[model samples]
Target chain A: MTKVVLLGPQRHVPTVRSALDDLGVDGPVAVVTAGWEEREREVGELSEHLGCETRNLKLFSRSEKALDKDPELLDALRALNDRMRTLQEHYRLRLAHTMGAVRELVARRGAQEGALLEEEIEHALGAVHVLDQHHTRRTADALGTFDERYKPTERESIGRARGKVKRDLSPCAALLVAGGHVAVLATRLRLFVIDQLIEERPVVAWSAGAMAVTDQIVLFHDSPPQGRGFAEVLTDGMGLCPHLVALPHARHRLLLDDPSRVSVMARRFQPASCLALDERSRATWDGKRWTLGAGTRWLGPDGTLHEEAVPA
Target chain B: MSLAIHEFLANGTPTPEQIDAFLADRTIPIVEGPEVTFLYRGEAAEVSLQHWIYGLESSREFTRVEGTDLWWIVAEIPPKSRVEYKLGVIHADGRRELVRDALNDQLAHDPFGSNSVAAGEGYERPDWTLPDDDARPGTLEQRRIQSEALGQRREITVYLPARYRRSRRYPLLVVHDGPDYLVFSSLKTVLDNLIHRLEIPPMIVALTASNDRLHEYADDERHGRFIAEELVPAMEQRYPLVGRPDARCLMGASFGAVASLSTAWRHPGVFGRLLLQSGSFAFTDIGSSNPRGPLFEPVVRFMNAFREAPGKPAEKLFISCGTYESLIYENRSLVPRLQEAGMTVRYVEARDGHNWENWRDRLRAGLSWLFPGPLWMVYE
Candidate 1:
């Protein structure tokens, strides 16, 4: 188990330096900014914040080189991505309809058709749950097929990159993961199995980084540009920190004031705690239980934010 | 009845001193609820408000305050409405001139010039349209391509999203009237903000301008060939695009909208999405001659023919028009026809004029629906 410190978005009010200070991590820090994609190499500010020598692992660049060197692997990755996209579209189509029905039925729950409304709501909600599970399973299957067929880690190019990453990460006091495109970040990390290499090194990650370390990656937005954004499971995370759905930029991304939506989200991802990790919020995992920072809260089942810590 | 202007004229028509005091501290176009009182002060034989609000008189004479130079007119505008207008002043010397509002500095610009903007109650510019310090900006590179179809070299402005990588392939958005969109509509800033917020995916946007905008964009055969046969191939070669019809979008406003539709119609599956804003889709369902003038002859002919057999221009379309535009009927008519032809259409109508700002406000709705970002699903 790794000791992970998850913080909110660092764009506005940066709490990374303080988080690092609290952890007493002052030596050389290795940073994985794969999420920043093209800007992965620009880590001057982050390094300065740490006030220590930084080893930029450059996982994004390394992945690019590995894929470039191996055309077969690149083609496989592309094909897999295409399949995943189709699967997601299918999931979205069904989720939209199911969520609509649920919302309608829930709104009419107090009507004269009370028992019927409740029954229909349950059925619609059940369909939603099934759809999520099916999508998750299909995603895993597709990814598994690609991994099994290609054996990416065994490939010469990828193996070389992974070896270099492990060597680069060896001497760092702690790991710092900054946020950008979460999917890209997570994919690069998984390719090199950075989670495995981290071992017992304390990891201080924020935003998408915080999401990446969790057991599951749930994409949530109440008012997206398109239809009503019903929260959906994007993919399985690295599984470093368990039983937590890290919601970075919660206030901006979610409609916390709407109790119905909040209740659905909290209940949908049951057993796991939905942490609202807005700016200045922090949650520390000491490889056992969570120690939530002041003002840090989790979305309770009754649609309220509670200050109680969640057990891992 | 106690309007701010009424208060200014409470003690009969205001004297020069009282008028000076009234104009000193008060913001022009005094908006109180739905009533907007426009005021102009000058020596003129006649002063009229020339506005483009549909269902209202295009030109309304402002009443001269008795014994004073103040010309004032109170208009009942709905809340959240933004109106662009000019003052047509007929001088004492029998000369006439159209001028922007001297008292109101807020303006909306286009290719021709600019107009004074009067924002009604509850109207505020969307914060997302402005440049944000946090939103990392995309790069725009100007490139010239020799178009064999049009037999001319064309300048194209490409917008590469911030943190763009060669490793990742992006969707392609081809915009008609590129320079105008950048200068007038703030397209670059909008794209940057939307991408930063994950409201829309980070994609490559191609801004295409024409030498003869009216002729070329009015459903010219060569223009269609240039976009479909020449431009798409060149962009795909230079950049890493998804290279599928579904991943490509063609967008434009007014005549540019006609260009987008006709091009996509001509090349059936070239572009899978079309964003048509305030489309000048003038069609003669019954008549023989073009009533909108000689400039709209080609547009009318193309639109009429297309209405007969639209034949699925794209898989999805996001069409928007201002309720205050003459083309609203045509836009509203096109939606049903598109839906009937088995296309997913999202049509939005705003209570604004047929100006760049109206188009600007609708970009978020249009772009997001066509290519939604990873906010919902990022399967990585």
Candidate 2:
């Protein structure tokens, strides 16, 4: 069984380190800090926290290497990236309009609880949901086709890096993934096929790390300086951990008090719990149900927010 | 030069018996004066002082002591203030070295630092500001409101003064970059101390957190509308705040400062006082436009508008930028414009670079001038 536990962003305090120790995940650990991009190798503090040296899987550097070595692959990836951007921009424009309409109607002066308006919003939201899923699936399919055509694993640079990483992982007890840019992290993970490579190894991920481990990756920021506060489904994750949308720093970024926003998010991403993973909060999975840790909260579809029941 | 050497050094090749005496005399003293003295003991062909508070071009050539292996310099710093400085050493063959002060143990504490610190006698961190076991701290309550102007649900953290009464009306200060000012600048602590000492009037500070600080802080009229139309009215309804525009203030640092000033300018009579620190007021001699990212285009547009229009909205405006900041010339140019508009303006430049601490240090001056406490600036 792959025992995975997601924790909060470890800034000054190592929330993950303590979780690792409790779960008995001793080193030499394989650390995937590709999320941090260029600064992936700066693991001195991480190693100190874990009480062991970590073997780094510099997936970011290796990706750059592959791109540099193959012009064809780079061109393909760039074209795909450009297409994705165009699609995202288009989606954002429509989503902003829909969300804005919904918000205004809800806050309209003396506007009674109109089921018709609610239904209309639901329909609009349904369209948004379809578009989001379609985009995510479309991205996955595009990536899948490219992966099959290129057989990126067969490439010399990728092959060598994978082999080295796999070999390094042979002695490691578990994998520790740190967070950075979610898109970059997910791309690196998909490029390396981390889910396939470390199928049985116990893993611990946090922040965007945890987000990347989920089936669907959602990007959210409520009060962004320039745009409507609408959380968009970016793409698909590695599917290692499923059935939940991981929201790190939810307290900091999200307006949890707004019932309208919370209800929309919860209902929009149906079946999957909108799990908030703030600092000191943890969610462990032993290949089954989630064992909620202290400070963890989830937004219910009923428009109510629930906090994790800490054990006595 | 007759220099009163404050730093102690063990320069000579000491014998075993004299080693203890040498170690005993190595206590460096940072003398408090109008012109502070700095000492360093390092082997280098040439040494120059590179201070953090001073501009990049402020490389002072250090002179060697008459009979000892030490590089020393004394310069007139701001009478009562603390600043960070480093030594730039050059080898005989032309290799360069820039580092912290070796003799002085006092250093500025930062995540990315090693900059040596020097404090003047009258420039000590006030005792009341630091976290005290017995001090009555103000309460910070997080609140969220729907903002149609900005098309988002924004979070606002409000600081209520101790012994706050529902019956009593308080002055309102809307601080941009609310989180940074609260966390990094220790704004609440400063407010608590200032209020407790009656240095500044007891006020309610509403920290408006920005989502895309860069984009929104520029020339976005939506943000200004959000503050004036939505936020101010909301605050009025919720808190016992003085409804008059004169009792209201808008404050921020860097782009946050730009947004605050822009908002106050955009919404006339909404805010009386503007406290801007290290504002990123970029421009060239020719026009109010220059090279920056796409987001900064709005900044230029807003600046140009401000230049063309009359600046009669804000009654009292306080503009401060660091001497070490690249925006120094722009800030300097802005002061005259505000003054020409017949607006009461105060301009200050600190020795430190563009950072939060510089803004924090100037808060006392800004707030006191804007909202003076009982008997403040008034002789009985």
Candidate 3:
């Protein structure tokens, strides 16, 4: 039951506030974005209008030269990989140890005598294996595929990049926005944060946050004159939220200017349900039906309004 | 006073015996000019001096020579109440540099920026008794349900001064995060040490436990009320503690620090002195729905409010922090703000983290400042 609102690009502060008011959510919001002084002022203005909190959340980017200069990040990445390998080896050794212990107990005492002891050892080993696998998978998901192009060379650069990771991890929530293939990198970082939050506390997400939770991300913007706004190769998302693909700013001109094009894109890439959210719209799932909120409307492939009822 | 001139020539060396005699006398006469000349062992040495020396204290510069070799130069520094000087040396190669003294142990940092100094392994634990025995009468367990307003039962520990049994009244220091402060910082031991030394006046220490720490410390007024209405009055009634604002002080660390500061600022008449350590006054975004929302900027509003309410019954503040603490920068920034508002503040930076080591170090200095030494000590 993690609540998230993915605001569309250049959406007014009041519009976002309206969405939050409709949801009956409180304030003290953390704003995450990129850019320089001007953008920060804009963010401040937005925060003032919304009566919440905002901070710069963007860390690593394809633009930052430090990423190219720093070798510490690469070293950290290698270290993380080495640690993961060691953990796997240790897990195997533990399994071997538990099995050996069970064998010893069985040999010393007959099967009838050592049955309870053996069962307890098996349960412990099973729990350890489950935990080890979870950790291994999480580490792998966080690291993702390293980019050879952005690999750092200098120690300071590497340290700065490492610092960025620490800072990103330190915050309770983060929002990452990317326009190119870098989105994959952003998704990986988001997944790492999600995995971290799962182990400790709850975290909320929005557009990219929602996309990070999904299995795959469908780029719904057409290339000015193309048929539908779907990317050639569909990229996998962080998969934090399972079985759902989130389409934010559903009513924005860039994505919804041509309904037919969006419809075609939706048909080509069908999610569990097309969550088309407008500026003031919201949809929540309570492990049951998709409870649609105000400012949101759903549609079918036939271009007809689907059954719309006020979610109670 | 006649300026002694034995060797009155430039670039001449003096004998070791003559230099020793000059130092033994510990008296150097002033020679007025842009530069000064001094005589020793038939060799005249000229120094570009700005000050002169009188007795143990000095102001002007002087050079010395020992036998055939030139010993280190000595400056006649001006007399000041506090000893403060840095050696300016002109080397043989005509290059001038400040002489480095290994014994110059005074530590300070750039007033405008942040800096850190190293400290050795900190506080060690001593054998202390805990009030855990259930059979003991008039213990914390017996006085558990003192107030009905507090939803849950909690143990409050109050420490009266050594002369509390005979004294008619005593000042009080109400502290939050009672268990952690009392255990980790060894609050009782520290209090005992301060009182025994007579650094601070005889006062009672009230330790109040925080049940919901985060909720109470999140810059809320309701949490302030819980202390003012429930805890303060209850303690006053139980102990021979002073109820007036001037005699009462509030102390806390981390989130508790923020709570104490906020409480003191809101009701300065209720609590005069504030001891804030590693307080979280910076902006946070954890509990907000909108990432860039205003509710998360309560600290900004709080700062603005504090700025407007400059002077009051709260006459003194003792703010301290560890160099490595996360809120070091914030605390550093807060000092000037407090000072600018016409409040007497003592800021201390220790070489540790946001833990007991820093707080314990602060306790002695803080107590001495709050309650200065007696008139006899000042005269003596």
Candidate 4:
């Protein structure tokens, strides 16, 4: 079991400095900055803040090289992503109309009409549920097909990268993961399986880094261009955080004031607390228990939000 | 086709009921019209017709009918031109109010003021946004705050339920353009009615005023710092506001909206919610070069800088703009950027132009959605 701490944004204040101090592990740090995309190499400032000999796992570059070396793997992965995008687009349109109808119906309540409206609303809600299940399953199936066919684990380039990543981690005591484009970050982490490479060493991650380590990556935006606001699932996460879905910068991204929206989000991701990763918020999993930080909140199923703190 | 003007008042001095019916029937605008005649009911007090289409001084002086004390004004108007107007009544005492048609109930309000609205046959007033009489009203408590952030003193108005208790905590709504909302939109009344109907939760609203609003709201860094460090803290000491960052919201219109959004982005710890109405979020492809204008330079610079790296998202944001507003396209474009930042956003558009009235009308839906209450079960 590895010690992992999920953190808030580090763009301005670098809250990670205090979190690292709390971890108290003294050694060089390995980083996964793939989320930065092209700017992944700019870890100089990060190294200065961490005060450690930091090295990029370069998983982003390695993934690109691996895909280049294996044209068949590249085509298969490209096809999977394109197929996922098309399915996602279709699913989004259906969801927007359905959710709009459901919300409108839910708002109607008069003695005779209330009962009739509630029934129709529930029916509509059920349809959305069924649609969600279908989308999630189809997405997994599409990605699973590529993995099953390519067996990228057995690929020569990827295997070499994995070996090098493991060797690179040998001298490191912990891992530092920064935020960027979550899809890019999640892809590289999946390909390299750096979670396995680190193997019980402490890990510190923030923003999309925290989201990537969770059980599912949910893409949500209430006010988006061209359509109504509805949250959707992008893909599954690495399941490192456990029984918890981390929403980094939730203060900036969630309609926490609307109980209906809050409750729907909490229930949609049931069994896991929809934790809001506001500024200076952190969650440390110490093998057995979780130590939540100040300013953290979880969306409650009862249409309420409660702030969280580490158990005394 | 011209619809002939036909109205009846009692042969003697008209009864209040008779006057009401006559005025209601006659107040409707003439559509499919080359010309139109408006009827006003009064015995002898000089009545002047002030219209949105024609300014106050140019109001048509009413002519008394030969037989009855009825007053009539005639003017040439285009078809489908919906306009709001008021009567300039000099009751011999010179005491006057920009009164709604005493007999007509159709009214429209903005942050500036409200007026009696008459729509051409084809022009439909958005009746849905109007507040109902039976809905409960909220109370406003006024105070003056000395802000160190901007080094200026300003008035802050806090709104709470009519039966508010200090023991219970409520979510905080920090609204910009406070004075305008109080005079024009009747925001306190809207909150009261919404809460009474269970459309939205009984929350505390802090209406913050600005001295140099344009410069302060143009993505001002010092203004952003002041909100986070001073204004919010001072308000907490005075009210039983919800302390959770997520429970708080920053709302503004036009430039004020720009300030709210930029402040939230810069200091994510202070506020979590944003309600932007017709925000001037101007941005350019090349950094620091804004074709929008000198006034929009700061907002353009801020948006451009944000593009370098997306900041943390706020909780849920409710954004709206009038289709007729110049900033509609800009507001629409900001939607995708906010979503990409992983923000939950609610975008609404009204048919009217950018004015306090359109923004005021949207308060019901936007506020109710953002802060739904225990009474949220009722439908308007």
Tens digits of lDDT, candidate 2, A1-312: 677888887874567777878888767788898887666777888888888768888888878887888788788878878877777788778777776776776565257667777777778777777877777877778778888888877888677777877887788888888887687888889888888878678889988898888888888867542245588877888787768888887876688898777887888887788888788879888787788886688887666677763121
i-RMSD per candidate, Å: 4.3, 21.8, 33.1, 16.4
* Candidate 4 lDDT by residue in tens digits, A178-241: 8777888888888777777778778898888888887777766544222356777677777776
User: B117-230 in candidate 1: lDDT tens per residue?
Assistant: 999899899878999987999999999999988888999999999988887799999999988999999999999999988888899999999979899999999999999989
The superposed Cα distance between candidate 4 and the true structure at residue B107, in angstroms, equals 24
TM-score of each: 0.84, 0.48, 0.34, 0.49
lDDT of 2 by residue, B88-183 (tens): 888778889888877778765443555776665467664544665433578999999899998889999999987677867899999998878876
Give RMSD (Å) of candidate 1 vs. truth.
4.5
Better of 1 and 3 by DockQ: 1
Chain B TM-score in each of the candidates? 0.97, 0.77, 0.57, 0.71
DockQ for the candidate 4 complex? 0.02
Estimate candidate 3's alpha-carbon lDDT, on a 0 to 1 scale: 0.50
TM-score of 4: 0.49
Backbone clash pairs for candidate 2 read A225-B211, A225-B212, B53-B351
**Tens-place lDDT digits, model 1, residues A54-111:** 9999999999999999999999999988998899888888888988888877787566
